[model samples]
Target: MHRHSDAEPDWDSLRERIIGLGEHSIHKSYYPELQDRLAELERFRALLDQTSDAIFLIDAETGLLIDTNESAWLQLGYNRERLMRIPFCNLIAPASLAWFLEFFASGQNRARREQVTVAGLMTADGCEVPVEITIRFVTFGDERYAVAVARDISERIRTERELRIKESAFESSTNGILIADLEGLLIYANPALLRMFDYEGVHRIQEKSITDLFSCADTDTRLLARLYREGAFAGEGHGRRNGGSVFDVHLSGSIVRNDSGQPLCIVGICMDITERKQMEELKREAYEQLRKNIEQFAILGDHIRNPLQVIVGIAEMIDDPLTAKILNQSERINDIITELDRGWVESESVRRYLKRRERPEASFAKIFRNQNNPE
Candidate 1:
């Protein structure tokens, strides 16, 4: 039983050993509380290494890595052995290191979260990573260090670039573009669409219905309903600009969807067709004009033809020789009269040359006068 009791903890010796280690680490004159605090920090560091943050301690003077957390190995593409050998700045992109060095060299304590555009990485295979860094300054003993935290922001940066490309395409598109949310609240409009409605900016167009710009609002409502239900709509509609001038436009609407296939927004395009509409109206007016002209010619032909036939019959019925001669001449006259009908020939020329009523053809009158006068 006494031999078994010897196996129990020697609490006094254990306490003395811990106290002796603390004295070795600090001066013998150092307060016990200060020594105790240093011990607590070592225990806290062991716990901090297990976290997901890419944590590292950077020496204040040289920015060399003194220690790193487990997350640094995964986030920075490095294993512990490789990371431990590198300066903290060696893992950072050159441009970013310059910016960071400025802050560190200032000697003023600082903390910030920043997007570093370029970053070098350290991998188990001796490769490097580009990352966004967030850091805070901390003091250990008499020395200062920075606790740098990092994350791989490559995906976020790629998304941002894609957004800029889409924006550029929308801005430069030729079609008149208008974008509205699911509630039909206008959120954006391209330059072509603004010029279409004579709106100077998107502000003037916000919250206004697609119907508001239309000369026919009821038609626009039906069109919008079809677009929502059918996912697309295309038809001609009339629109009025700021000056109250109306024009024909073909409106096309399309529904925008998200990755989940949920309806996100409505995009509309307006294509002008004013000249085509004007041409159609002009054609309709031309057909009516042609009809009226044909009717007038039909009536004129009936009036002129009927009177000439009766005059021709009376001239044939005459009996006396002189009267018969006159009738025969009159019959000849009727032929010219028919030929002169409807201003087709000059009327004054017919009067002077053919009628012979105290007037005669100039050539005939001259020859006869010379024969009869004999002077």
Candidate 2:
């Protein structure tokens, strides 16, 4: 190789040329140290670029972005050159402009160290994005800078909003809702639940186990077992109120499970069905009485029909008009009694007539005479 005695140095190519001098050059020791410094700076920049959070180096005095990482470019939807030219405050939403000013004004004398602030970022499309920002003042040579690490918290904000809505619905529901752990300890009960059990406050209900609310503790255990196996249970049962009075209730519940399908808790709703149960009982009793009345009507009709048949047969042997009319009316009365036995007439009215203090046969005679006379 030929060596040049003198050559004008290419300033842009100095880094490569200095490193190439290697061990044989007079400046070898200092050049290697310089190379190490450059390598450290490059590694530091790479670390910032690889970070998931957006990183920005801002000039504290001028409020301008000195440098930014790849995440900052992607988050703000802006290129590096544009971000560096714009003031850092321009990227904040109008609502958060005063807050940013205050943060920057604190400068090195910041009251809080490494405090996280929630703020909004305005993107290229003029959309505001929620972010959590941690900021600290860093000194580099003669200048002070604010280094910011911002994490997008849009999903977290949305999740919190949904949770608030569900909590509101749970508190405001009209039906009695109860949540209990696997051990049957009551974890939560809504206002309606407290009132349903005639309790004045939630603390009173909280002190009682779920089994204590039910009329039968054994049935409650069986229901809990079914809920564990099937993930849900719905049925009617008797619930004891605050005064120890039992009332019918329709309870529906389902097991709340974790992602692994392990049961976490049980949530249930109760509806008062005492009036409905009483009405059902009344209907059953009425039907039973109707059945017994029908049977009695049949037996009484048979007893009267046999004697009436003999009277009508004897009257038929006489040729007199009055006797013939009596025989005809008696046969018609026998037919009416048969119709009652067949349920062709409303049984309630017949039962009332039979149960009356006045003679039922007198009413029957009156009806037969009116049918025969027709006048």
Candidate 3:
């Protein structure tokens, strides 16, 4: 195979020609070392291609891009060819650039993994992407090159932000969240958790044990131990709030694991059922009050409605025109007052009554009927 000594030799045809014309006559660029080295490069390149993490090389001088993979193209929102020419510092946040330059300019120790936090890599639409970059500094034949492995934490970041938002919300939340270890040692509790424990705030709940916090700790411990071992445990448990006041909690819990699949922590989410649980105790007191109000209303209805009924009956019995007219007017007024007191007057009926100079008795009754049953 023939290759230009100064240029990138196109070996595509050389492979084909070698198969057809035989290797003996040709001065092939493909030697044993060259072939082995080329194969090694191909395998390494394939490994880089297969990696989900975005990998790219940058020039140390101006922080200019040197080359990048397909993931870098999609991630930084630039074509590989376009990215090669741009200054790497341009993608970083202005506040961080000086710090980054200072950090980078320090003599690089080759083959060391370094983590750098940089904000805002520019996209095609002028939007910036936040990236956490891990750079591996290397010197390739006296030319400085840094291989960067970047993960698009955008989703992870968003989830984290949402989780933070959720956490912040949880901190100030009405609901309580308590975190403990496998041995039932308390690690964390939100303000709401502290509040549920009625310890004033989060600081008070700290250093307090479930054993100390609970009155029925002896009975609950065995069940709780079983729950931590079991995945996705949920049940009812008795919890003691501050001041030695005991309360019930509808407790739900799960085991927390790290990347290596080892159990690191346990988080228990709880709903305070103390108020709802005391429905049985408060039942008699509440019923007594409600019963009183109902009886009073019934008595008032009887006292008011019966008199109006008698007046109407007597008005019919009267034959004298003036006497009958006055009795009828009083009976109608009584009915209107009763409906108004019972919270039965509706807006439309009131509007019509206000619009009319004198609402006729029959028209008023019709309006009341409409108010009583609106369809």
Ten contiguous residues minimizing lDDT sum, candidate 2: 359-368
Question: Taking the candidates one at a time, how many backbone clashes does each contain?
Answer: 2, 0, 1
For model 3, the superposed segments whose C-alpha errors exceed 4 Å read: 1-30, 93-95, 104-115, 180-185, 195-212, 216-375
Order of all candidates by lDDT, from best down to worst?
Answer: 2, 1, 3
> Please, what's the RMSD in Å of model 3?
15.4
Worst 10 residues of 3 by lDDT: 359-368
359 Cα displacement, candidate 2 (Å): 42
Model 1 agreement with the true structure over 1-375: per-residue lDDT tens digits:
579778889777666656765424344456678879999998887777776657788887778888888888767666788888888777766556677777666657343423233455554565556566766677789998877777766677789899999888878877678888776677888888788889898898888776677665434455555567678766666778867788787767789999999998999887776776687567657645645554555566567657756765765676645756765665676665455454433443443343354321122123223333434
lDDT of 3 at 198: 73
Clashing pairs in 3: 1-28
Q: TM-scores across all candidates?
A: 0.58, 0.76, 0.53
Using lDDT as the measure, which candidate wins? 2
| CA lDDT of each prediction against the hidden true structure | 0.68, 0.78, 0.67
Model 1 misplaced regions, further than 4 Å: 1-53, 109-130, 276-375
Write down the TM-score for model 3.
0.53
Candidate 3: tens digits of C-alpha lDDT, residues 1-375: 655675775476676567645455243545666789999998988888777777878877667788777777777677777877777777666766776676677736433336566455667678767777777677789798767777767888889899999779778877778887777778789877777787776666666665565444344454455555455555555677677777777676788889998888778787787776586347546645655665565577667777777877877787877876777688777877677456423433443454465322222123223333544
Better of 2 and 3 by TM-score: 2
